[model samples]
Target chain A: MHTTDTETFEEQFAIEQRLVDSVVASFDSTTDPRLKELMQSLTRHLHAFIREVRLSEDEWSNAIAFLTAVGNITDDRRQEFILLSDVLGVSMQTIAVSNPAYEDATESTVFGPFFVEDAPEVTLGGDIAGGATGQPCWIEGTVTDTAGNPVPEARIEVWQNDEDGFYDVQYSDGRVSGRAHLFSDAHGRYRFWGMTPVPYPIPSDGPVGKMLAATNRSPMRVAHLHFMVTADGLRTLVTHIFVAGDPQLERGDSVFGVKDSLIKDFVEQPPGTPTPDGRHIGDRNWARCEFDIVLAPEQI
Target chain B: MHTTDTETFEEQFAIEQRLVDSVVASFDSTTDPRLKELMQSLTRHLHAFIREVRLSEDEWSNAIAFLTAVGNITDDRRQEFILLSDVLGVSMQTIAVSNPAYEDATESTVFGPFFVEDAPEVTLGGDIAGGATGQPCWIEGTVTDTAGNPVPEARIEVWQNDEDGFYDVQYSDGRVSGRAHLFSDAHGRYRFWGMTPVPYPIPSDGPVGKMLAATNRSPMRVAHLHFMVTADGLRTLVTHIFVAGDPQLERGDSVFGVKDSLIKDFVEQPPGTPTPDGRHIGDRNWARCEFDIVLAPEQI
Candidate 1:
């Protein structure tokens, strides 16, 4: 056969095709259907992205640089990249899609980006609110089965914003002092006092903040309290119980953490009621609330 | 409500949730959906991968350093990262799934790691044989439209390795010598003289080679000639014309460059027969082969 003078553009596209072959060949064989599908889909999308964009020399370099920056920003206490994910709605989507909590358990929200293990422990009915936010308010809750039967000695941990809407961990140390951990009593009852809820803006100095500013968005979060409940043979629950009347409750609660079932109204009460801890308040205006959580079966 | 007096693991998870909320609240509405998806997926996968693999601090650091090295090795003339794609099969898979050749053009192959611009102009029938690899051979081909009409004055740029499997470009002037651009005559005929085809190993000294080695793979490629053809009324075509029976064809070209249609046999001719340029072969056997190229319509 005589050699042809010209080859078609299909011949040229072969270069790209060969690259794809090599890429798929590199993945490990997996039996997990989801993983397999995800890997294949990711490869397909990534390849298409490169081609659709006709990614060029300098553009490819810029992408590499961007990834490097993401890695550089991650640290022990700060995972800017993870924070970046949470803000992008990916974290919520992934968790929601993968593990739908609508089957009786409380809807799990995104695990926020800040946490310091080993918060100081306190007993039931102990005060956790350090003098930062405002006048004290009493919060009480019960840990029970779905039938309302108290689960004796169930562990109930709680933390909330100080009067100024900041947690103790946000500051270096001793400057904010608002974090507290508590466990339920023998009757599955728990109570504590702290400043009233207040709205506060999220940190705007990080790259996440910069991303928000670039698109003309705000970073405020509605007032809420953090809770973790667990007991023998029961599934652990991670949730945020929001204050119903806080101004930011409806529109400002970041990460879509609001659930009608989790919202509680704070009622003003006469300062002095027969207190379980024996401290009498002189009939002054005070905040009071009561709620109970039902435990789910443990998947483990 | 009063601050909580007790703390539990559930409470800690709640705090984590709040932090997540605060962080996610920071994203603005203008972020790219793809980027958002990518970041979120990355976070979930990375977080899961870490947990699944039980990645230690040392392992994580080493992975980071490896990425840093990949970045460090990238520069203007070479991209080790792309080579990473080649070995990982990402490059080949991407090219394959997004093949632009199915619209009635030649089968495509990978754009090997090395290709250069600036080929010197040579007239039709010019010889590109310079490096000392295989026996001498004459290559001729035609460029035509789908209807078999000749396309006059199409530019055909040719390149290939000497018998020893080293490209002329890899040798002198830090640039090769045999690579040249030739304009087809009115007959759409283009011809060049070069060494007979022989298999050559891709560069194994680079990171790609290292990866291949780690995976117990070889890097030999079948003998072939590279070309980039273009004309005023057609889309540009960049491809390779492979020599049949060079070995390593069916088992797959190590660089994944083989296409069934692109391969051709080099028929042996008596030493004394007149060659395409009317030059007699001197004392040694010579070979000849012919092929044609069909180009796509011009891209607007």
Candidate 2:
């Protein structure tokens, strides 16, 4: 007794197309144009991805479960979704798009999860490796404008993992080390003493780690130091300088933070070498690196 | 002392492209070809989407938070992610892709979150509106092959919300109503006395509902009855029959489950009219609908 009419494939596709239109139209009343645009673009790309993959019911369910796991494993100390994005190269791509191309400016990478606000300020050539176990290293850098003019009194924030490949916060001993804030002097020069960088595996105990394992990808990042530089009339610069000869650089950093221009040689020095401040270095051998930063002029 | 080299936009894009390639290549060792393909395609599309959107850090954080909220709100009684997919048209697209068009076959839609296992069975011409309140109605259907041959004794599972827009499970009163199982008779015929379907809002109290509100979209679905038909030699069919001329049909369903061919007239019958099974006329008027299902041949 029911009607015998059936839809052809073309008709079904039309129905789906209409659905997409309806979803896109639903956002027309959004108060914020940017949010509307984002929602519309997200809907289109999500639908297209599903269709392109011919996603099956089981596959969809698996995706849902995987995402749920990713959410569940995320917490104060870990950001599995960001890790997922990083592994997919989305984080780096976003940085590239957001920063665009600025001549002579330090290239930005992912502002990783370990930055601590208001790290203790250090004086020129001061040691920031308080109670941290690592090879002693001296870091000096100069701040300059895109036009090669020295930018005096620019604030430089630096943080990095110790030789053991762990940030100061990662330790449970309630100690602060391996990170500090400093300012460029009148000559646009700044220096600090810290630990030699060591390549480290990203936290690999969460859903993101499981995904990496399943996909046969390593979770190692090239040894590096994070820097954030700011001056009154210059655009802020957030970046990392990778050790020039680190093996992980050639192998591809897990977070895709390595840039050829940002790599620097961490020169080795024997014990008892004269320090930059006219003091004799300790008996322990040390390494040194100089990274000069150039900032783009801020748009009015 | 640091190198003054800077990468151009083209070079940065090339680095990202290589990173994407590396991520895709990581899947080559996957034992399952389908999973490998899915992961690779997912990586490529995800990277493309990020680049196209030029997603900002704040936007990325918002996305992560939104997904986490969706997962946190999902449980045994609700599936927020599926609702997210439904609202975005991904669910309908997936259904369309999964179920290809077949001659004379019923069109499929999404299998929503309310399906329960082992619903009570009803015999031919049996009443399935057990101890529930709604306008009386009769539903009759036939199961046949694409060639119009009757497929005797096919199983048809039915479920729907009551006039109050609540499924039996949605009620805390432990009442059983609005859903049941029925089998076709020898001639591939089945009939059940039920209740009139009514438009209802999808559970809008969670993250999905918030998303809809944020996007200015309604969460209403047109009046419809869900059906799942299965026979020995035919592919199983899961779909819904919407009430013809339901206002929501043209307005667009919240879940995008509506199809032109699946909409049918629920003809109203006045009191004192003889029933199809020769039953006595009742004082209260009732509605009647016939939905015949034609299933495609199952692949071996």
Best by TM-score: 2
Q: Model 2 chain A, poorest ten-residue lDDT window? A: A1-10
Per-prediction DockQ comes to 0.09, 0.37
User: Docking quality tier of candidate 1?
Assistant: incorrect
> Model 2 over residues A1-300: C-alpha lDDT tens digits?
332345354575676677678778878888888889888887777777777788987788787778878767666556677778887777777787778657667888887777788889999899888777788888998899988988999998888888788888777776788888989999998899887888998878888888778777788999998998989989888899888888888777887788788999899888888777765666878899999998888761
After superposition, candidate 2 runs with Cα above 4 Å error: A1-19, A29-31, A115-133, A149-159, A162-189, A230-233, A271-285, B1-31, B116-136, B149-157, B162-188, B192-194, B230-233, B269-286
Count of residue pairs whose backbone atoms collide, per candidate = 72, 0
lDDT of 2 by residue, B99-141 (tens): 8676667888988877777889998888777876777788887
The 10-residue segment of model 2 chain B with minimum total lDDT is B1-10
TM-score of each: 0.52, 0.83
Candidate 1 lDDT tens digits, A1-300: 222235544554555655664555544344554444444444555665565555443444454445445445545445555455555554444444333342345555555655445666777767766555565677887787655677887766666667665666566654434556777787888888765566766666776666556655667767767777778887666676677777776565545556677788777666665655666656666676776777766652
* Interface RMSD for each predicted structure: 9.0, 3.6
Docking class of 2: acceptable
